[model samples]
Target: MAHVDPSAPLEGKASKETERKLKRESRTQIVSFVFMVFITTTAFLTVASDVIPSGFAIPFILLLASVQVIMQLYYFMHMNAKGTGWVNALIWGGLFVAAMTVAALMLLIGITKY
Candidate 1:
């Protein structure tokens, strides 16, 4: 058996875990980027294609944009990471307020035919 130095930092074990975590995060980011790219291409194609009606394509693209935004916030912004509860709350609260404001405006101004 080999003698171990107690003074040495246990870099092997810690580094391995850190390496695995970084690999996982990198893979996730790549996948998210690819997905976002796909969504953008699809959105562009939808707009470019004459077969797709503007009404449906517009909403579909908006939905995809929202998905991209959510992924960006979670992955790139690291909102889902450690000790970001306040940030998450603030962001979500702002979204809620904005949504409510839009809804109220739509209702009051009769923006929609409904």
Candidate 2:
């Protein structure tokens, strides 16, 4: 038996299905990256420009941030892939708990005036 070098490059053309899948994945990643960059730019502009009032700008920027986070998780992190139902549920549950905790804290702070 001969030993195979793991570091060596693959020697043959990939199957059609594999090539198609790769192309689709690459396209998705590129689109997601571009969209994230656009979101970042929008957030920067929102903060930099004085035309948009703070009252509106703050929430708008936060909304954009949330969108970016979701996109990052689903696209960059591969959370949208198949067979990740349990992982998805756990992550979403965690996020829900964190959001609730923050809300509760904010309420307490408001009530205590601290």
Candidate 3:
């Protein structure tokens, strides 16, 4: 058998691939963070100012909040990474159930009659 080098530099193809992957992840995280901040500021301004009506602002802010939650889950929680298939399935299923429950409640409350 041949002796192995103990002090070899980690500069092979695998290292390069990992470096590129890290760079791409960093860029995506930065972009997502900026988007989250923008959404938050927009929501705050919408509520602080009288430009948008309350009825429109509420729904708009809710939509933005949901988008922000999705971003947080995918980026911060790494839900899009490998080996997270089951986690994704569970989270999405929970969301579906919650949405259905809310829809049922809304229907019972006669929201469409307004």
Candidate 4:
């Protein structure tokens, strides 16, 4: 058995847990970045193809983008893992109001006839 020295710093078990959390965080960020890149590239291709013209597709794309952004913010941003209920509730409330406002305008304005 090796002798322990009080003067020297010793390795603590917390280091392993800290490292694991860091790795998980790094992985989450990388995955989020990859997903963002994929979404952006797909958006770019859709815009370039013009098969789904911006006039017809922009709103749909915007909705998907909002979802993806929320996913990243909630996950990789650690909002879901660390935030209080009030914080999350506030975010959801904002999203709901934004959606409701957009829906009201679109419906009231008769923007989508098709």
Candidate 5:
């Protein structure tokens, strides 16, 4: 039988592989956050610049914000792999319905009866 070395770190101690994995995960979160920010910032800038017609700005901004919210829910909230499937479906469904209602109202209010 071989003797165990007391000077060596225990198996539970952080190994290089574990550290690398953590660093990689951290980078992923950073990247996701940065991309979300970039998308929203650009969307706001476009709306403010009046480069696109006012009719297009609201839809564009809402679409971009929805995408960012989804990304944040999946990446930052750790909901990508966890169960909670019903909660996810329910919330997103509600949001979709609300968005559709708003869009329909906007169309009705802006359109001419003639």
Candidate 6:
């Protein structure tokens, strides 16, 4: 038996299907990254511009932030990939619980304020 180097780089051309998949994935990542950058720029502009009132800018920035978070999770984190059903469910469940907790706390605080 011959010893082999485990850390050696892989050799040979990948299959057509694999190459195509890789190209598609790279394209998607590029697009998502561009989109995220655009979103960030828009958020910064919204906050920096004096024409937009603080009332509107705050919510607009928040909306952009939410979109960025979702994109990061789905694309950068590969949450949208196959065989991630359980992971997706658990993450969504956690989000739901967090949202509900925030809502309940807001309501409690509001009631106590009165």
Please report the candidate that would top lDDT against the real structure: 6
Error of 6 at 49 (Å): 1.3
Best by TM-score: 2
Candidate closer to the true structure by TM-score (higher is better), 1 or 5:
1
Indicate the TM-score of model 1. 0.73
Per-residue lDDT tens digits of candidate 6, residues 1-114?
398998999899999999999999999999999999999999999888889999989998999999999999999999999999999999999999999999999999999999
**TM-score per candidate, chains pooled:** 0.73, 0.80, 0.70, 0.65, 0.61, 0.75
Which residue pairs in candidate 3 have backbone atoms (N, alpha carbon, C) closer than 3 angstroms, thus clashing?
A: none
lDDT of 2 by residue, 1-114 (tens): 299899889799999999999999999999999999999999999999989999999999999999999998999999989999998999999999999999999999999995
Model 5 C-alpha lDDT per residue in residues 1-114, reported as the tens digit of each score: 299888987667688998998899899999998998899898989788957987888898888988988898888876776697987898789988998999998899889653
Stretches of candidate 5 off by over 4 Å are: 1-18, 86-90, 93-114
Compared to the true structure, candidate 2 yields what TM-score?
0.80
lDDT string, candidate 4, 1-111, tens digits:
387787888665668888999898889888888888888787777778847867867886786688688878687666787546887888789989998999899997896
Colliding residue pairs in candidate 1: none
- Candidate 4 displacement at residue 68 in angstroms: 1.6
Q: What is the lDDT of candidate 4?
A: 0.79
Clashing pairs in 4: none
Model 3, range 1-114, lDDT digits (tens) per residue? 297787887564657888999899899999999999999999999999987899999999999999999999999899989999999999999999999999998898897676
The residue pairs in collision within model 6 are: none
Measured over all alpha carbons after superposition, the RMSD of each candidate to the real structure, in angstroms, is 7.7, 3.7, 6.6, 8.5, 8.6, 4.0
Instruction: Note the Cα lDDT for every prediction shown.
Output: 0.92, 0.95, 0.93, 0.79, 0.86, 0.95
Candidate 6 deviant stretches above 4 angstroms: 1-13, 105-114
* Whole-structure CA lDDT of model 6: 0.95
A best-first ranking of the candidates according to their lDDT comes to 6, 2, 3, 1, 5, 4
Residue 73 in model 1: shift from native, Å?
0.7
32-82, model 1: which lDDT tens digit per residue? 999999999998999999999998999999998899999999998999899
Give me the runs in candidate 3 sitting further than 4 Å from their true place. 1-14, 100-114
Residue 3 lDDT in candidate 3: 78
